[model samples]
Target: MTGEELGRDEENTAVAGPVDADGSAEIGELIGRLSGDDDLDRETRGRLLGRLARLLGQSARKAGAAGVARGKWLTDLLVAAAPHIPIRDLETLRAHHHGLIGEELADSVVRVASNGTTAVGAAGGALAAVEFVAPPLLLTAPAQLAAETLVIAAIEVKMIAELHAVYQVRVDGTGTARGAAFLTSWARQRGVNPLESGSLTSALGSAAKSALRKRLLKTLGRSMSTMGPFLTGAAAGAALNRAATKKLAEHVRKDLRGGADPIKPLPGGYPSVGPADKP
Candidate 1:
């Protein structure tokens, strides 16, 4: 074939290539270098990490608020279904991280079940719950918001944990795990229980690590599109949150079936576990 004809054929082939999972063309090598590079200047790396953290925090908070709203709805649904859901204690809830973690976790789970990757399933379940209850937000704004925030925080915790795993960050019981512990303690001070508060940290950390690796592989599979580091990070966070939330909802569903109580009592006040508990 003539050189020009060969060139045209190649160009056309490129144009016809399949799109990446995130809708962007592949920029695998670049993304790998950026994500994997540890030798980059500290300032640059710090900035990138900070930016991602901020985005995640903001997304988490928004998601948390949404979760609180959903939680209120779910609580009402539970009550309607059994008329004896056992009123969740505000004092107990407060002990669980200022209500932030609880709100985020609830929100995250609802989002996963409602408008997330498994939206169909979530929506079905949510609708069923709604049919039974009058809807929480319309009834109690603060409680609803708190529940949503708890769910979102749970997803974020999982996401961060997952990222730490992918990066091979030593969990020597230090770093993120420690941070999570501290956060848990902080929540307890406000009256939230460890079961709920600790769950958020664990969920977020696990989700982040798992999602980061999955997203990395997904980014690698495409051919033409390139995802900037920032975008990739965000996408990874979002995906991880969605997955974690779904898992959490499944757990919740199981608990509900088992007649689990909404809030559990913590062993002690704040920081239930200590440094020695680190593994």
Candidate 2:
């Protein structure tokens, strides 16, 4: 090859080298960004979600190419990505709910988060239904499923983080450290252990790994169950997602406390609704 051609090739390789150089770290950063409490506009929020989904899709693709079973690949991905899922900080969450505090703030967080997860489930179901009939779209199902899995996981992670905020539990760490703390909580489906050290390591251990795998399998099963005929699948998908999110939240709440009543609602008989509550 000519010298000029060789130089151009080297430049291209240099540019592509760093993109996948630290795959896990990059994935964690993306998750952190999505789960963070940044005040992004609607369009920007949508774009970040899309980016995270695409990264997940690529992760699945790479694993499949390496001969990993689809189910196992997905479980592994979810476990690795969980800690990085961006969870909103208490200040941002409280601000969004305006005058809500304690149980009332917690209620608003779950309500909004459940709505978001349910929407993702419905959309994923509809997409699956479409892929069922369209030959041209069949190849997209796995990627779509992978994306859906990450998005739903992120939502649940957020729920876990915010619930801790509600209970006045302090999770120690900033940035990824904080994210990892809650990731462990989500994997175990329980509250954070304030006394534990290096929660990120614990989260990646065999016990946490097993827990996450089981949880993801259950979620995947629910998604797969909605793969019937189109209309039926869509309806089932929505209801299934909504119910599942509520169920998960209730269980986590109980684990946080012995199924106690919601922190008594704030005084004045009602919460001052914030802008977040508006459509």
Candidate 3:
């Protein structure tokens, strides 16, 4: 090559090396900006940390539940068939309910159940596993489950209200009357029964709310650094319940071929009788 061409090529090579180094440095800086630092402002750090924590908790819960569901398919199968393999007492139920809902709401339900001398109950011990899992996400299985249950409950109430519309039942009192009216109307439109819907709503609502409170109290008992355990446990439990429920519903739908679909709405708002209702 000519001298001038060779010189130009050498200069070009020298310029390219620094440009490559500069590009690498810029990429490193961008990564640093994305990650931020411990010394970042409290609000910014907290928000980032919280988001990371929640993401981790959700992932963990989903994984854990899937593992548990595979191992205990038989137990889940039994629970789906009978809907009452593991019976829980009032206090135990209270705790589960708290986890599903929140403290105050669960407490209210407990008080109401106690006053009427009516015992509230739930099906399957899968939720117990959930209580054991979620803690990292600042939630319990019951708390997460409560949201699902509320969706179920609202559907039940709507069904009952619709039923009342069909029967021409004028329910105009307080408490039970109101509940009955709502439930009746809810069931009719939903093509279910008020009593059945009411039962599921009561059971799920009670369990989720109780579980939530227990988690909060446990978190409060620990120091800030140790709070991760509570949040992790809660997230784990919620994830476990979701997976277990899905598995159980699938098994039920496959094995139990009745008019009742465990994953779908029952004739009323009862615990999803078919696969369609599985969370």
Candidate 4:
């Protein structure tokens, strides 16, 4: 084949190749890095953390303007983005975490996820505070907070999915199907239903939608406190995010645990457990 033709064919193959391969690998790498021991120096960690926070802020801005999470906007936004979220399956997760299993695996997931959400909040808050100094930036605070809120939601949703995997709560479907299920769980701030039909239709009932909207508004309002001037806003933002993430992890863990006995670690740090409801 001619050079140009060969190059064109290669480009087409690249474009048609499995997109999730790269995306899934990236998500796995991100989770692995975050869940690993804190080895980076303080300055390096701070820089990385800040960059993540800024990225979350950017994501939040794309979801909505004026920080209003009402009606169908939040729901629609999530549904549209659900297919793009990179969700690793159980085997993939096990590989990423060095075969850690049961409660230890679960703990690492929650810790890293919480750190991410808190970083988003602190970064968004700091940016918002800076706006107070520059009047023009004042107009941007709501958007920044909005971005932070969405980004935090995404992180928590991914955590919920991985936690389900940790507990061996098998969710059946394509990656997008599983993502929608967990995305719904994230919106409701609740645990996934193992018996759920794995269909998007049944997930977004009127009542659930209403509750989701209310919850989003409440979260956004709390984020507003992070808009205070300077250091005050930054401190409040970080604390709020940290506490919120911790609370979310607790609630999700409780639901996932489902009154079952604590997961006992097996040989090689993997847990030999299944969902409590499973026979």
Over 140-239, each residue of candidate 1 has an lDDT whose tens digit, in order, gives: 3222222222223322333222222222222222222333332232222121122343321221233322332233223222100111132343344345
TM-score of each: 0.22, 0.69, 0.20, 0.66
Listed per candidate, the RMSD to the true structure in angstroms reads 22.8, 13.0, 26.2, 10.8
Error of 3 at 187 (Å): 12
Best by lDDT: 2
Alpha carbon lDDT at 177, candidate 2: 38
- The better candidate by TM-score, 1 or 3, is 1
Which 10 residues in a row give candidate 2 its minimum summed lDDT? 1-10
Candidate 4 has which clashing residue pairs, if any?
60-147
lDDT of each: 0.28, 0.56, 0.27, 0.55
lDDT of 3: 0.27
Once fitted onto the true fold, the runs of candidate 1 whose alpha carbons sit more than 4 angstroms away are 1-137, 174-177, 181-279
Ranking by TM-score: 2, 4, 1, 3
Candidate 4, 1-279: lDDT as tens digits: 100100012222111123233233232233233323345453454444444444444544554554434535444444433433445656766666788888988888888777776666666666666678899756555555555555566667677777887887765533343444565566555666565331232134455455556766677777887788786877787788778877887877887888533322212211122233322
Among all candidates shown, the one with the greatest TM-score: 2
Provide the lDDT at 72 for model 3: 31
lDDT of 3 by residue, 80-155 (tens): 1111111122343435445433334333333332221110001112222334455452364332222222222222
Q: Which is better, 2 or 4, measured by lDDT?
A: 2
Model 4 per-residue lDDT at 268: 28
